[model samples]
Target: MVGTAAQHFVAVHGVGHGAWVYYKVKPRMEAAGVRFTPVSLAAAGNNGKKLEEVRSLHDYTTPLLEVLAAVPAGEKVVLVGHSGGGYPAAYAMEKFPEKISVAVFVNALMPDTKNRPSYVIDEYLARTPPEAWMDTQFPTYGDPPITALVVGPKFISDSLYNLSPVEDQALGHLSVRPGSLFMEDLATMDKFSDDKFGSVRRAYIVAADDKTIPAEFQRWLIENNPVAEVKEIKGADHMPMFTQPDALCKCLLEIAQKHAA
Candidate 1:
């Protein structure tokens, strides 16, 4: 009923990725009559900002915040986050719970008030060879090493884009930038109350074949943070937008319709 006609969606891309990641899904959502806005967080994907410029959790997520703030009053939006994009979605939910009708995590990190993005990242990094898969340090910040983490192309194909088309996977490796880890920023801004973020309805779309976040970890995240519903995209890797846009779009629409006013 409420969403039977149309609904608005603001999709956020994961770490190292920019608005470009949502390219494949945007046209499909449009064809389906869903309004879609794909955003590239600061210092990410054609944003023209360098990774070194990102110094805080807020800095890393400013673009997403800007987009949410631009939403008109009394108008609610469905916030969707993929991979590392989940942190911003959660932060936005906490900051503007009233504006978000529902938050969706798509094969992404689901950090709670008690959790931090650094902790979630560490879990994934532990499973891979840091030297080979990522850039552990750069001259971005001083003293404590506030460098961004960059994913290697080899790693992307194996873990994040295994199920995607060869050309799409290549584009992913070439286009992805180094994402700000913002370990310190998240450590400080990680606190959220149940009345804020918890009050917003949440959903998770699990990439059943994800090697980046992994299906088990996605389930673990849900168990800890909890959500109203769970959907699965079978055979999808971490980048389902490219590997399974149709299914992902359908799932997103289903969530919107199920929770529509």
Candidate 2:
């Protein structure tokens, strides 16, 4: 395990999820004397922004970028992203690599800019049948864009929260919101370069039993975009923050201590 600076830790959530997903593990970081900021992407969580308002990738990620900017120069933070949060985390690393000590992807998308945003969703849908996704809906590509993606209640428990507590699953159903897929923006974006995003050190946390991004796909991502080290926790679903908080906390602290500095 690599060691990191033990100062600040920033976390970003996946699609249809807010910072609330990290609530279970935040306390562990706090107890360890690390500063933790769990961000809600655009319209997700208590951001109060409407789904229609997130028109561009810039709007969707401004909050995360802003937080990265707030870190004092000469001081670096350990940046962590889950699922859809990985894309923005990659973008942030590209934009401000100096501020990030390390970027950690926890069962999240490991974007290379070679793969378009649509590829992420399409891959999931390709491997998973329509029934597995339940009533999850996507926006139509047209003049008046649908703007947001919404995962259904049944889909939440079935695919995402299968290993989580029943009450925690209920909280997810009640608080989930419409989220952007950023397909249009990613389609037009340039591929990440070695001098930019690839310069930053990275790590991957594999949820072995992940239903959303299966174990094979997770390894596929790791093979595509290599990381400094790889860690695994078996029986963990896509939402390990809830199902494996203690294990996740230990993994993160190890990452921060080994890779962040």
Candidate 3:
């Protein structure tokens, strides 16, 4: 296990959470003596931007890239991505392989190293069973990078969402809403991959109650991505940042430790 003291973690929000989701999360890790940094996409968090305003992957990466640039040349960071945040985190990994310490994919929509972001949801569109998790189409807002879709528990049901805590839903904090079309298409080319990237230490946390992207889908994501550890979180749904901050924090800390070793 990575020693508890003096570890650095980068917290990335999937869809809605800007850097603020860590407000509840950072303290727990700090209490444990961990140093973590939380980042928001261009319009996410308190940025005064709307989801519709994001036009491309670059927009989604704005906040995260700032963090990456701030890192010293030789220092690598432990990446924690929630929801769509995985894309840019992966992109960052590809661009700055040496800068990344490890990766932690939460109840996140994970993409393949070479695939476009679309592939994560493409499987469901092609699923024989068909996914009832979403509405007719994703909710339309301003210019968007990836389609920011929010598939809440009501649409997906308790079984898939059983892992999510009710308190998370009550907070109504995660509402970034990922768009499937343009965002998924971004994953098609591995423009970011180089020798340094594509093989960083990686982990995935499966949310048992996640209706938005069920465990089965999460499994597929992990299988396609290059992951070293896969942690299953029971009774927590799609938004663990709200429902189970400590659980998320613990998983992140563990993954960072594993990579450090």
Clashes of each: 0, 13, 28
lDDT of each: 0.81, 0.82, 0.67
Give, for candidate 2, the lowest lDDT window spanning 10 residues.
1-10
State every prediction's TM-score relative to the real structure.
0.91, 0.92, 0.81
Error of 1 at 69 (Å): 1.0
* Residue 30 lDDT in candidate 2: 83
Residue-wise C-alpha lDDT for candidate 1, range 235-258, written one tens digit per residue: 799899988988998998889988
The reply for model 1, stretches above 4 Å from the true place, is 1-6, 115-119, 122-144
lDDT of 3 by residue, 98-200 (tens): 7777878887766664655567657745662434644334655543335555556454334233444555444443443433334544745544443545677
Model 2 alpha-carbon miss at residue 180, Å: 1.9
User: Which candidate ranks first by TM-score, i.e. highest?
Assistant: 2
RMSD per candidate (Å) reads 2.5, 2.3, 3.5
Best by lDDT: 2
